[model samples]
Target: MKDGDETRQREDTPFYDHPTGGWGSLKSVARWMVKGRPSPGVLDTLRIQNKPGGHMCTSCAWAKPPNPHLAEFCENGAKATIWDLTRDRCTPDFFARHSVTELQGWSDHDLERVGRLTHPMRYDAASDHYLPCNWDEAFAGIGARLRQLDPRSVVFYASGRASLETSYLYQLFARALGHNNLPDSSNMCHETTSVALKSTIGSPVGTCVLSDFEHCEMILFFGQNTGSNSPRFLHPLQQAVRRGCKIVTFNPVRERGLIEFTSPQEPGPMLTGGSTRISDTYLQVRPGGDIAAIAGLCKHLFALDDAGGGVIDRDFIAEHTDGFASFEANIRETGWDGIEAASGLIRADLEAVAEIYARSPRSIGIYGMGLTQHVHGSQSVQMLVNLLLMRGNIGRPGTGISPVRGHSNVQGQRTVGISEKPELVPLDRLAELFGFEPPRDEGRTTVDAVQGLLDGSVRGFVSLGGNFARAIPDQGRSDGAWAGLALNVQIATKLNRSHVLVGDGTWLLPCLVRAEEDRQASGSQTVTMEDSLSHIHGSVGRRAPASGHLLSETAIVAGLAKATLAPNPRLAWDDWVGDYALIRDLIEATYPEEFKDFNARMFTPGGFYRGNPARERQWKTTSGKAGFTTPTVLSALGAEPGDAVFTLMTLRSNDQFNTTIYGFRDRLRGLEGDRMVVLMNPGEMARAGLHEGQRVTLVSAVEDGKTRALPGMRVTGYDLPDGCVAAYYPEANPLVPLGWHDVESKTPAYKGAPVRIVA
Candidate 1:
């Protein structure tokens, strides 16, 4: 840690190029709802609990409104229901007064503000601390350590704060306790938009929904950042920029809600002093140059359809689609000097962004995890569905191809299964509706559960609500492969850093969050979810239950499937853990074509859309239609650049969400009091001898042998692009290096890696 030993003085981080949700986004949602201390009647019932017929948004799967707009939520869904309905708790005299080496010296926003994990603890190891079990001794010590391990040595994981009847009863108690391993948080963000839109739109979801953001005429976004990771997706991009639509961002950092917002709940742009304009063209684009800025907008839409200018679609590409002549000979062999030196941009700004998608005929595109956390993140979402199927933008009216998703039912916990490859549904309809026989193998995903817990074939490890060792990535080798696991549980409600990095027998159960109130025996229940424009609604939790020893994530997956299936009786687990509409009638007997009448359309008024047969253009693939891929990595995004290497990408901080930090300040990229700063680009900080706030160390440029570095960090500068830089992720996740990532959806590359700063 050189650059002047400890470094400080350059604290002027605040940048703010105007616009984003005014009153500085309602004073940063009243300073994260007065530091999650809620009251004013639980902040007036988190303002109609998620909305419409109430209770749904547990935050970011976006797509709401069967009718909303009276503060339907956004200020990070009122700072994620004031961080799980505040009223603070974390009892057992606060884990017998801290220790796990004293809550590992606090901070993950002070160990979730020392609150809410009211009961079920464990991990005693003779007072390493956390000792208050019961819930029948933490489900009979996690069912006698899942009957002394080896149901593929247990793994589980599932977060996106569960529910879809607790991720279908935690994948039906991990395939009825015989293992499927599950893995989750959509195996690190949109498992590359569900593996490149189900290999080019056969469908893997998101073929447009939320009223296609009110009849889109053009939107774009790519490698998204609208108001620091989904701020109520800036009110349908501020009502499609007040309906004159025409967004178009790109990334490499311009963000502030895509440069111009102000919808502090939009009442005529928050009572005049207006501010709508959202990116009518932004660009920046460089860290892993999103496949040379989307193959220079498909080489300017194939040179405006071979100069005839009829802008392709030639009768919906000869009825539907499939390899358009090798994707128009790989976009007429991508030229423009490797798309203007890997899309720093020029060539008339990719022909003025392909003439705003060739004079828009209802477009759309959006993206996230900055093009799926790069390494050619699933070939930059197959060049965003090859620029939304070059116009016939997947099934009509206002076009498709979104991704967004931060959580709030991570695309409905993979639509009720929470996969790690459960062979895309149907194992004889999950063994004829949950009786047994399901695990058809292949599981362990968040990077094969850290190489199945460093190869002892994953000895236990549970999770079900994130903070999995600080949202994974070689964190000092996932904190020593989760302290050489052999049982770690976590279900969680507050305390984090994966519950003091558990391991040698850990438990910490404590559930019921999504804003509390979840009962059983045919009383107060209403779970279901599946947003990111797929809908499937129903949420219901109006306060009360930050404690009473918590519970309900479907009664802790029916008390760990009745303590690991003892006397199983083909599972009843006390009448579906005392009724949750009998787990939505066994998720409509294992997904009977999109939950056929799942509880009479979840009390209507805004919760039932789940359709997407490629939004009715019905290309359900295998050559049945729509495919045209071939962006063959736009000349591997013009490879070169390594004069002391740079390309970093790791972000997620506007007062964090996603590994929930809620503080350590991001004030929308004007940072503060460090979260290991960075940003960069004052002409590559004077060609790399860096300066502003200089204290660096980054390192890693491929020596896969793992020893990555990261050190003190801090850089600053800004308006990126030249050899890029950034920083944030699970604290630059040890310079990243968990198999770099994304060779068809192994995701990771947290947005292009190859670091080097060092000073």
Candidate 2:
């Protein structure tokens, strides 16, 4: 296919884009090719086929069974299904056929072609082989190396997919082993949101629940794409629209999911060619300019309040919050000209949004990584809280702020206390429950962990679920730093780029996926997940084990703890992991108020609701109320004007998860079969004297002077704003320097890194 034709095919061409539904017919043909013939009695394998009453599918442990009557599978859920059910296996002989060095040259997809890893393997550098090793030997080797390092020198990272029991035990083991370096995926994604929310509302979670959307009169979605990113969210959004909720969107790219969505679950709507119109009004704000937009809206709202309009909730403001006087002063000082210039929005557009918010009886603001991946992410989040507070949105039905989390259990992980700096209260509880005081010193965060590896302060690394090296920024430096470690351990399901970037002593330990059942002494176990709305639900795996050698993350951590810290007199580690219930008991003992009746609540239909002081409009600040945080002089990008460098923004594809690629296709932007291309506006392309399909190197303009000249990078033209270009992460991460992170949040400014695009 021609490049243009290929781009067209990939770009926003939905399954319903074609007259006969583009992928519908092709999917049928592909199914026949694989299954020989379709039987009328044969159920659609891709659809949710199981009955509604079973425990979470033994295959991909989702919390609830699909309603046999409804659209049984979500888009990303389908991707996860195909990934798990693929009739391919990676056996010991496959490793024997190709040495580790040879396999290292293969792409992430090709490595998966060797199929699922069926046995435990250890990388031997001298022989260039990943030979099969027994579980005992693997555990012993990992334990001995971990014992060799000072506990502080070893970093334990967890991913959101890990069970609550596993996460609780992992943190317990790290504390028992004398370290607090529990840097997980949360640090990289929504740590800023948590920090901002906790400081402002006295809660680290969203105050609003999914039912709030139904009650909402107006919904303002900032920087989040619901359809492409979170398909399940489309249901609530569609329902809200049907209820006459006014939906306003602020995103750089006009996502199809935001404009119109045909329910994949509702066959009648799909057959009738009817779709839900999500956004009542769409505003494309410039990248890294969310704060300015929010500030402008607040300025407009304050103006209305001053004109005897009384849009502000004087009672709520007086009783529930502080620092309003100083906050109002900052908004007054910020001028319309500055806001317009920075946000790329006009005064009228700002007024229109403000008017909708002011007139509406109830409103909610939702945002995603787009607003939090910049240098002023925390400030931007605070601004959103400020906007909500202006109108008494909190502690009300259908009104509040929501940071749509990406992973299923990202919120749950943090709730269970997977943090680098566990608060003093939690630490006290840990000490009392576990009979040992956790190290009082704050340990490494995600960025700190990377720096520790670089400075040689960290010698060993253990990742529970995520691909840390690949998911982090500055992949070039991260690769080297990770490889330099004395021991690196990855517990994962599928093969990814991180697996190839091994340390001196590397171990790839396969573990049970969320879809698979985890059995222990406590009988069958079900893990809990916290959704974006702060609703905790149970996730029970139903699929059989993929390999007998594979261990549940809970068991793996327990085995490692036993092998490494058994000799220490800190605490009883083996007793905790012998049964996950003990771990849950400890967790409940530590956070009694939150996890009270923990086991009893798991059987509840929808699980439980985590307490949010903000929902009660009770601020948990030092002064016993919500407080507006006055941000210092804000600089969206630290780059100087007239500097010939373009800012790079890292993004995900429709066919991918955070760092896991289901395929190389980006169907939204019309990019096919390749992820190395950079998207730029036509005007910017012309300004740079570049043509379509031109390959260019991206050089970081940060102080470190890091350079990554990826050759054959197709320069595709898009509708992006001038002076900005977009590229896929992990590939484009080299363009971001380690030192160039958000000052307050310390989040890598992945969405805004100064770079010079060149041919």
Candidate 3:
């Protein structure tokens, strides 16, 4: 903690070079909705957000367009709907004038700008503040500390802002208290695109849609940053670059919303600032070089299908795939100088992006969390599903493989039953539709729930909404294991630093947000989510509940499952919290082949499409087809970077989203106030003797003798990719290392992490 002691302030600026949803995204949505003044019925609930019975635009999941756009949301979904309909608040005399050790020295954008979160407080470790408490005494002291633990040591988690009837009643109140653990927020970003697309296309989601960006023809991107993490996917890449398609991208920061944008709803390119260019080839690659740039674009599309050049779809790979002769003999025995020194490009630019994916007849591929964080992030998402199944591109239409997800129903909280593995959910149909027996062991992933709260084997934490101590990853070893918890709950709507990191029985509990109005007793309710193309919509809110003492994440997971289970009768839990269509008829009796008719295809319009058994090409894996894996590490940082190291990665700045820090500007890399800067590469900041704005520090190349580092950090430079760097994410999440990650989806490799800088 040295050189100008970090808690913000590093102004730098210059480098935005414009064009991303023009008029600077309508003046950053009119200065973040007049700095979140919200609540004049929150501008009439932003005119029913993604429309059709209105509501689902609690930000990034990017799908909702089925002929929509009378303002079909964007600009960080209007700063996450004016940071969730703000009107300030915080209450209980603002946590009795701040104390949890002085709001732990504030600044996570001033700890969620101290707003919303109205009552249900608790945590007074004798005057450390947070008083209010009631909803049945914080659910009888979090159900008497989860009835003396051991329900697999109690964790729960669930933050894709709840809803599929409060994540099936918070994973059926943690598998009827017998524990299926259920960690969430997609186990920290796309759990390696769900463990490498369910082992190469047996389906773990994303087989295109949103009219496959108007019948593709080409699109590629990787290590995604779709104009600040899916800004409503820049109006389908500006109508697929005005109908000619062709994009391409790869990344190590050539991102300015994929190089050009414009549509603040297109009024003649917002009065002729006329833009729409978007990556007609970008390629920087490097930090964990996406498995050597997806195995050098599947070895130059297998040398253009062995020069016969019909660019392989060899009759849809001889009848819909499976290994392809040891994946074309491991891409013709690899080496093109180890794919140009682990893909920092050049082989005639990967054979000119494999001749624009062999003269595009349809493409698509998109990606994010820079090809899923790293340590070979599930073999770079199974080598981008073996370059979209070498052209048989997973079941037709403008091609497949998307990923671009950032919360907003984090893939519908892993498709309605959060998960901590147990064979990717369905525990014998939720133990015969709720009579019990659901545990099935394996549970705990948010890096094994912060190594089970620093190894006392997790004593109890609940969560429902996120900000889990500023989105996990060794923040001073998870805030010194959050006060050695014996129980800590959250169920939030604001007041974040994981609700004042308290313990020995905390509580918080402020719910109701997807833009308000929840009501119950058989009336006004309507939830459901799921995007990132597995579709299935319906949202509902329409203003008015920022506080009436909140509550409705299905009535606080059915009043904490009627204050911790024991009533059963097939789990009525107060008639599924007074009717959420009886929790979508027990989530269509625990997934009847994916909620068949769950409430008559939920509000239709742009809402239903839940099918994707490998996009109807069927092959739900175990060799029923679509396979081709062959990876053995092409470059998940197994080498290079010997000079003052680097490879950093973290990201998320266009005014943040995931760990929700909505300001400290980052108007597409031109920075602003600050979030501890970094971004390097002006010749690696003069080979790390650093300069431009230098405050330096970083550290963590982890041998674990402790000392993670991340001091002042300023740096700056830019046009990245030479041994790379870049920062912003829970402020470089304390230089990472919570046992690093992604050795097959433990996830944390927050884009690569190896750090070094120093000075």
Using Cα atoms with residue i matched to residue i, what is each candidate's TM-score against the true structure? 0.35, 0.92, 0.35
Better of 2 and 3 by TM-score: 2
| Residue 6, candidate 2: C-alpha displacement in angstroms | 20
What are the per-residue Cα lDDT tens digits for candidate 1 across 1-759? 112211221233346645777887788888777777874466666667667556776667776677776777777777777777777788888778777887877778888877778788888776688888779888987888788877888888877868787788888788877777787877777888887788788777778876777898888887778687776777777777777888878777766777778877657766776887777778777766777777778778878878888886778878888787887777677688887787677788778878878888889888888777766677778877877877788788788887878787877777777787777766677787655687787777888888777666787888887787777777657666666687888887888887887667888888887666687776787777877888787877767886787888778877887887757565787787687778788888877788897888885666788687888888777888888788666523223357787777888877777778777777665667788887876767887778898888888877766678777887888666788688888788777777877777776777677777779
Question: What are the C-alpha RMSDs, in order, of all predicted structures?
Answer: 23.4, 4.3, 23.5
lDDT of 1 at 576: 75
**lDDT, candidate 1, at 366:** 83
lDDT of 3 at 14: 48
Per-residue lDDT of 94 in model 1: 74
Give the per-residue lDDT of model 2 (tens digit) for 298-332: 99998998999999998989988899999999999
**Candidate 1 weakest lDDT stretch, 10 residues:** 1-10
Task: Give the local distance difference test score of model 3.
Answer: 0.80
Better of 1 and 2 by lDDT: 1
